[model samples]
Target: MIAAMLKVMVLGVCRDRGALAMAFVLPPLIFVVFAAIFSGTSGTEMRLKVAVVDEVRSDETTRLMDAIANEPSLRMHALANQSQQSLREAVAYGNADVGLIIAGALTQDGEQSPIVIVADAGRSMAGPILSGHVQRLIASQLPGVALRRLIPSVDMLSGGLTSQQRAQLISSTDEMNTADNSKSITVGESGAGLFRMEVLDGRGNVTVSYYAGAVAVMFLLFSAMQGAASLIEERSSGIMDRLAVGAAGTDVVVASKFLFLTLQGLLQVGLIFVIAWIVYDVALLPHLMPWLATTVFASAAAAGLALFMASACTSRQQANTISSFLVLVASAVGGSMVPRFMMPPWLQDIGWLTPNAWAIEAYQGALWRGENTWALLTFLWPLALVAVVSLLCAFALSRYRLRLG
Candidate 1:
C-alpha cells in the first residue's frame, strides 16, 4: 500500500508541470531574490551620498565637507556647484542622493556657520538621517555669535589688537589669501582646514540611505523577470490560439495578461517587503505612500517586461532560458546584485539605459527621498510611459501576427 501510494505521488507530481516547476524553482528563486535584496552593509547605517559644492573655499566649509564625508553616516559625493537645482538633478538622475550647496557668502570668514543643505527629496537613500547629522554638527560647532566671539578673542588679543580691530585684521588676512588662490582657504569655515567625521552606526541602520539603489534595482528587476515568466507559460499551454478565436480580439488577451502580470508584480513586491519587515525591520507603514507610488511603476514595468519575454522566444524553453539570462545579465549591469560604485566607470554609464536602473533609482526616490506622494508624480510617470510603450508594441504584434509565440 505504501509503495503504491509513493508511485501515485510521483506520478501526480510529474503530471502537474506547473507544480513541479514551482517546487523545484520557487525556494532557490526566493532565496536568491531575498539574498540579493538584503545582503550587505550589515551593522552599518545607511549614509547619504552628498555632493558638496564649495564656493567659498574657506577652511570652514572644507572642514564641514570633509567631516561629513568621513562620517560613516554620509557617503559624500562632492559636486562643483552650490545651486540646489544641480544637486537635486544629480539625485533625480541617479547620480547621487543628497547634496550640500555652499554659497560663497556663507563662508566669507573663518566662521562656523549654517550652510545650505540641498536634500534630494526625490531619491535620497538617507536624507533625513544625514540632514540631522549635518544639523547636529553645525549646532555643536556654532553655539551663538556672542559665545563663538569669546572663544577666539583670546587668540586675537595675542596679536595685539582689540576685539573689533582683531576681527577686521583676520577678515583682511582671509580676503588677501582668497585673492591669491581660490583653493587656498579651507572649505566652509574659518578653521585651519582640519576636520573629522563623527557618525553613529546604529543610528544609520534605521535610515538605509545608502542601500536604495541596491534594493530598488534588484527587486524591480525581479518583478520584471517574474512577470516575464507568464510569457513562457502562455507559449507552453497554447493559450494564444484560443484567444484569437473570439471577437474579443488580441488586445483583450494581451490586456488580460498584462493585468495578470501586474497583479503578480504587486505580489512580488509584497513578498519582498514582508521579508524585509519580518527580518530587517525596515519601515513599511510610515513609508506606505512611497511604497504605493513605487507600486505604480512596478505595474507598468511588469507589462513592458512581460511583453519583452513574449516577443523574445518562440518556445517555452527558449523563453525561460532567454528571460532568465537577460534578467540576470541586466541585474548585474544595473547594480542589482553588486554595487554600481564597485563596477567600472563604463559599466556604470551603460547601466543607466536598463529599466532595472530606472526602477532602482525611482524606488530610492520614494524610500529615502522623504517626499510625500504628490512628489512622486515626476518620479513615477516614466515607468507608466514604458508600460504604455510595451502594451502598444504587444498590441501591434498581435494585430500583425494574430498571435504571440
Candidate 2:
C-alpha cells in the first residue's frame, strides 16, 4: 500500500520542477539566511563603535584615549576637534555606541570629578563596558584615583560625606577593586574548567538554534501543504471521481498522501539540519538519533495536518489560504517566530495546540539542550498522536466528500 503511494508521489514530484525546487532548493537557502544573521553572536570578541571628543587634548587625555582605541573590542572614531554636543548626538542618533568627552584636564588632585559619558538607556551594556575601560586607563595614570565618580549619576548618593568619611570610603572601595582585579578565571589542567569549554559548545549562537527549529517547522507545513495540493487538483479534474468508483478506496488515497507528505517533510527537515551542520557547525552528530526521532514525528504531524486541510477545503484556493493561515498562526504562537520564554505565560500554555510547538521544542531540547532520546518522548508521543488522529480524520472526511460528489 505504501509502495503504491510512494510511486505515485515520486512520479508526480519528478514531473514538476517547481515542486522539486521548493522541496530541495528553498530549504537550504532559508537555512543559509538564518545562519548568516546569527553566526556572530557567540564570538569571543565584541565589536562596539565609540566616539571620542578630547577638548583638553592634554598628554594625560591623549594617552587615555590612545589606550581605549588600542583595545581589541572597541572600534574608535576619534572626533578630535568635535564638540561634546556632537559626541552626545552621535550616541543619541545611533552614530556611535558610547561617547566620551574629555572637556577638562585630568587633575591628580585629591578630589575626583566625573568624566562625561554620552549614552542612551536602550544599550545598557555599552555604557558600562566603555566606562570600565576608561576607569582602568585613569587608574593607570593616577594610581588610587577613586573610580566611584565614574558612576552614571551623582543622584545615586543621597547625601554628602565628610572628608574623613569619604577618605575611608575610598580606601574600602580601593581594597575591594584590588581584590577583584587580583583574581581571574582560567582553565585548569584537569580539562573540566570554564576556560577549557568550547565557546561554541552549549552556548553557540542561540539565534541559530531558535531559527533552525522555527524554519524547520514553518517549511514542513509549507511543503506538506504544497504536496496536499495534489488532492485538490485530483478532485477538481475528476481523477478522484474515477478513483472513488475504481477498486482503490478513498482511505487508500488519503493514506498515500499522508505517507508521501510525511516522507517529503522528513527529507526537507533532514536537509535543513544538514545545512545547519555544514554552515553553522551545529552539533548534529552527537545527537543524531534524538534529532531523527524528532524529525520523523514532526514530519508525520505536518503530513496529517496537510491532509486534513486538503480534505476539509472544497477548492484549491481555499485549501491554500487555510493552510497558509493556519501554518503562520501556528508558527507565530508555537515559538517558531519568537522564543517561548519571551511570550506571556498564557500564550505559552496555548502554544501546545500547534504541532510546530511540540516539534520545535523537541528539536531544541535534543540539539541545543543536550536532552536524551527518552526525555524527548515527552513531546514526541503527543506529536505522533496528533498525526494519527489527524490522518484518520482526514481519511474519513475524504471518504465522505467523495461519496457526496
Candidate 3:
C-alpha cells in the first residue's frame, strides 16, 4: 500500500508544474509565511532589529523600552541620527526590521495627566507585536496603582451580608487592582500618515515592496540566462555569422538580442503582475505612473544582464550552466527565495548588491507605499551597472569573434 501510494504521488507531481510546486514548494513556503505572520509576541526573541522613536519622554516610555530591550524576540538598534527620515532609511535599508515611535500622550475623563503609549505600527510584524507587548506591560504596571484606588464600595445592607464580612471581602479584592480606563486605543495620535508609510499593505505597498524586488530580481536573472541560451543556439545554427556578414555587425546582432530579451522580460513581468492581481488580489495600479515606470526599468535591467551573459559565453550549454548558477545563487542571497527579514544582518547587508533586492524594494514602494519614483533609487544603480557591464560584454564579444581561431 505504501509503495503504491508513493508511486501515485510521484506520478501526480510529474503530471503538473503547479501540483509539483504546490506539493514540494508550497508547504514549506506556507509554513514560513505563517511563521512570519504569527511567530510570537516577543518578536525580539526571533532576533528582529527594532528602532525606537520616542516622542513622549516619561517613566512609562522608559519602562516600555526597557521591556523591549530585554525581550529575546528583538535586537533594538538605532540610527545614530534618530530622526524620522533616518529611521525610515534604517527600515528601508534592512538595518532595522521594526520602527517604534512614541508619538504623544493621551488623557482620560477627570484625569489631568496624559497617558502616552506607543504610536508606530512598525515595518515588520515586530512593530505591532512589540507595540502590543509594550502597551500591555505599561498598562499592567502603571494602571495597577490607579485601578486599586478606584475600586467602588458596595453597601452590605443591600446585599444582605453582614457589614464586617462585606468590608473584609471588598478590602481583599480591592487589594488586587482595578482598571481606571476601559478602552484600549493602540495609537496615541492620528492614524493618517502612519498607515501609508508601510512598504506592503493590501492596497499594494506591502506586496509591491516584497514582490517587486522579488520578481524583478528573479526574472532578470532568468532573462539573462535565457539571452545567454540564444548565443548557444546561434552558434549551433551558424546564425551569428550570417547576420555578421553584412553592415549589421556583431554589435548590431547583440543589440537586437538585447532589445528582444528586454521585450520578453517586460512581457513576463506584465503577465506575472496580471496573474498576481487575479490570483492574489494584489492591487496593480495604485499609482499608475510610478508602477509603469518600475516595470520599464526592471525589463531593461533584465535585458542588459541577458545581453552581457550571452556575449560572454562560448556556447548555450556553457551559458546555461553558468547563468543557472548565477541566477539561483543571486536569487537566494537577494531575497528571491526567502524573506530578507529572516536572514542574518551581515547577509542582508550583502544582498544589497543584487538587482532583485533593489528592484523588489522599488516596485513594492511604488505599488504599495504610495512612494514616488525616489523609491527607485535602490533599483537604478544596479540597472545602470548592468548596462555598463553589457556594453563591456559587447566590446569583449567583438574581440572574441575577431580572434575566434
TM-score of each: 0.55, 0.53, 0.63
Clashes of each: 17, 0, 24
Error of 3 at 179 (Å): 26
Off by over 4 Å in 3: 1-46, 63-96, 103-124, 128-202, 242-245, 278-281
lDDT per residue (tens digit) for residues 34-126 in model 1: 354334322233344667776676665665566576677556665555556666666554566555666644323354434554443333234
Ranking by TM-score: 3, 1, 2
Per-residue lDDT of model 2, residues 317-341, tens digit only: 6677667667866776676876543
Alpha carbon lDDT of residue 194, candidate 2? 7
Candidate 1 structure lDDT: 0.56
Please estimate how well model 2 matches the true structure, expressed as its whole-model Cα lDDT.
Answer: 0.69
Positional deviation of residue 40's Cα in model 3 after best superposition, in angstroms: 16
lDDT of 1 at 351: 68
Minimum summed lDDT over a 10-residue window in model 3 is located at 187-196
Overlapping backbone residue pairs in candidate 3 total 24
TM-score of 2: 0.53
Question: Which 10 consecutive residues of model 2 have the lowest summed lDDT?
Answer: 191-200
lDDT of 3: 0.59
lDDT of 1 at 225: 60
| Top-TM-score candidate index | 3
